[model samples]
Target: MTALSEYERLEAEGIWRPDPEAQRQEVILSLGDATLVIADDRSATALAHWSLPAMIRLNPGARPAIYAPSAEPGEELEIADETMIAAIEKVHAMIEARRPHPGRLRGALIGGGVLLLGAVVLFWLPGALVDHAARIAPQAKRVEIGRKLLTEFTKMTGQPCHSPAGDKALAALAERLPGQQVIEVLPEALDGARLLPGGLAIVGRNTIAGPDTPEVVAGFLIAAQRGAAGERPLHRMLDWLGPAAALRLLTTGDLPDDGIAEYAQELVQHPPERPNNDTLLHAFREAGVSSTPYAYALDPTGESVLGLIEADPFKGQPAPHPVLEDAQWVALQDICSAH
Candidate 1:
């Protein structure tokens, strides 16, 4: 407030326009403590007081400088007095020097660095921790957790289809598919095949009752493998289940029942991502299973899965072996129907 002592009694004549459409009138402009006062010179009545900090000059380094209360709106003062203009500029410079300017190059860099650190803490750290947890988990532990998930899934979907003939047939089907160590057919609440922490893959009874060939079922298992994307199913599960779940499993050597149940419920609610054409074709080739039946099962007309059908690994030839033997296919189809 006491900075501009030299301009204590500074007064100037200025043309004031209250608005754009109003008539301009000569007014007395005086600087007060932290304010610029505009008064009717003849009537000696104050017209307006603009806070010095808020006042903005419309034209800098121009004669008869124009100013307004703010960068917004139209009330303006046109002043010709050089002394008043110079004093205003000096006060503005002092104010600018004291204000925090984060937009400055050095400040911007510091602010950006802070934001980057915050992003790593909020997003990247949790993901990295989950990956570490998954990487360190032994295959034995993964199989243990996977069977536990199967037990939980059964609670929501009922017991998986099983019979003397069906179990043997399903075991044969799993053997035929390869890479499918644990395969079960759920009665309900399973949208698609969900590969669990170990090499377990669960499918719906509808797919069995629906598709003519077991190759469609094998396709579902291959698609579930794509969900891992070269990562283990445990990693995929922990990623979706979040950092808390990963930490729990890592520290306690088991996930909380609530978290496991929630994951089981969520699994039925969401379908696993489909395997892309290239991935499915590669998997089919590796397993010696034809991809055409599976491609058609995905899209009856094969319109959307044209790539899968055309790129079938066994396009010109039959599968190296049947996906299921004639009797096995019939027995597998009757697996869920038995009980």
Candidate 2:
């Protein structure tokens, strides 16, 4: 492995006890491509060779780590050297990377054939084809689709709000979400939040402007994440366009610009689908944000979103962390204003 090349023939002094009954002895630990060679310090005689792939860290994240061969539990190696421990961890990661992923090959084979056939079957069996395509399409393609959709979406909603301070605040807010997905704020035309294809999320200007606390914005972001988890954006897109367009996307990696533009126009006018209250509450809990603000924002009367408020994750307690700083929230509120 290329990762091993950097530490070729690297050796270190380590205390290796042969067994539970034996006293610890200083051993010369030599790094090998596939094995760790332990030798007697004085005589330079080989003691034991541990397979790199089979080595397991016993005391993970400890100062002085312990390791043993996965198969041979009777023997143990204690290592106090940080460099040696880091090397072993790196080698383990490299070996794991080489192992075959269970369904990757099968998915690739199926994905290759599905595109053309999926397009034809889309007219008669839209749901199945869309689900299959959404499952099979690679992450890169999903990102591409999301970007294209955003471009089209911008046509109807206007350009995303961007000021130097606002951009920084937006980025900080995005970091709170899983994967640090891009969160774009639209000046108008959006009712609330929508998760785009890939990990992108879009929110309306009103969502930020209407609420006094950043918790509401954070709650909406978590709700968008919950909605995206419930339904993949690619599946939604394919359902909107049908088989022929999906086939074109599968084969050529693009959809008609006109179709995307039209869809964007329709999407701007409609609010994104809301996830069930339970799912949203779970999301809010995970993000350490209260659902009360979002609940009241959805309905000032608090009648429709009573469930969210009643089952609020951080109800009657302080949040684990503030969603945004006071300054950041102020910057975010004036995102559309010129710097």
Candidate 3:
């Protein structure tokens, strides 16, 4: 776009030192995005970016605007007036406020003519889109797409599984995991757990076989399944896809190839919204798993997990399953850290 002003040129003069410790400069003013990043000029090479939003002012006298590189949160110096500073601060505030509120697909899009509008798109070209995707995307492509989406985040299998011990334990529990459920308990699932468009249930390493017992893992699984029941897996997928992309998928049954990367990554890095307790409890009951075990697994003293136990679906009886052989349990524990 526009040419840089003389002052702007001076502001951009400083470089983001990669080394944070080497320079040892305290951050004066930090704000914006998701991280609180500081700037260092000397050890420009040693700086590491944080997830919280932050701003750093090199010259206290002149409040210069700083921009960090997309790949690195290293800082750059620049001059700015009150107007610029206020604008930047406002943007920072807005993004921070929105960060905690996650996106969901239910009532957010379920009103009046939304579903009708989506249905109309289907009539325009019946089977055309699905057929096209089928032609281009064979089983291999679908598997790849599924894998890409799956690996994007650290998913919890709701089993607290870690090593092959985790896998074997889950395998034993899997016999009882709702017959319709397709659960995947990874040793190091990045995201907690989520249901996908298909019947795929993503899980994290800390889920079923983490440090907790099978009870906690089963609790989360029940919660995820309940969430899926309230909202279709396709709806959850569409919710994460955003409005424009959802419409495109409804119209053509094909998602932009590149969009999958970020979507998958979000699965591991971000936590999904939890369904209401009523709905979560309903699913837990359907799964025939106890709430006490999961509740205790969630929090021993019941401070944090008190609500979950109080909301237990079945206070009746524990499901039947074999404990893994001690050796197998050890294997599952090491699964997440394998790579």
Candidate 4:
């Protein structure tokens, strides 16, 4: 095995802090493609090693594990058959593409592995990573992120529907949405709507205030939920940000200040390629909103959404009551829009 020159360089530069009182320090090993580096950081020795394509770290208290690219499917090593670690491995494979240089690649992979460990501790281990995130994420920051996203969603569709009617309609619909969910109607989004992690959804006020009724807005909400349930808004978010930021969200529960802008832009520009109809159907039925409204909103040509309405999930069922009261709707309608 060749010496990992890159790792050696980083160590020489004091990038690899060897904590003798900490635990073990095995020379880093790499996966076959050299996309990731695995280190046994449980020991205290400093015998530096080269990189490999795949490796595992075994700490006495930690779960025995393997960190392979997601491409290496199936259980590499059965670590109590934990699903979260499996999910993490799969995600790693999905994101760990071949880097240009072995050295930098080694650095990124190892760094990612450490971050991965952090995420596992933060999210998958046992406690509530989502709740932790909520607590950690400032209300002011969340609201700010929400406002900027509203601005971007508006800019993308070129539909300035800041009219009172549109605002009123959005208020009515917002009242009916889930309390845990973050719902906002922008004056844009002519083409599509999006749901994000942390209980947030964005749509064009036009989507809500178009010829369609409040039921349609409700249907779109269901569809967004369906999309989120299938792949988790968090996964979609992490996918957009790449794994590094995803890892940060998992641990710290907050992204960089600019991360929200990047996420909002991606949400506006990139709609979900395929939202599962079956899931959407269930969501619609559960929400008591007819699928027709949402279907038409997706495509007014009646070609795409027409079928959804025709084969309505609840048929004559009415959607549940609003998340906000009539007055709350009015208040939200004017929320920051006056400026």
Root-mean-square deviation of each candidate, in angstroms?
A: 12.4, 25.8, 27.8, 24.5
Task: Give the candidate number with the greatest lDDT.
Answer: 1
Select the stronger candidate by TM-score from 2 and 4: 2
Cand. 3 TM to true fold: 0.47
What is model 1's C-alpha RMSD?
A: 12.4
lDDT of 4 by residue, 185-295 (tens): 555444446765555676655543343255655666666666644665655555555555655765665566577677766776666764667767766666666777667
TM-score, each model?
0.64, 0.61, 0.47, 0.46
**Model 1, range 74-146, lDDT digits (tens) per residue?**
7999999988888889999999999987679688899999999999989998998899889999888888888
Cα lDDT of model 3 by residue, 54-104, tens digit: 444344445455544334544453435464455445545765676754344
In TM-score terms, candidate 1 sits at 0.64
Q: List the residue pairs that clash in candidate 2.
A: none
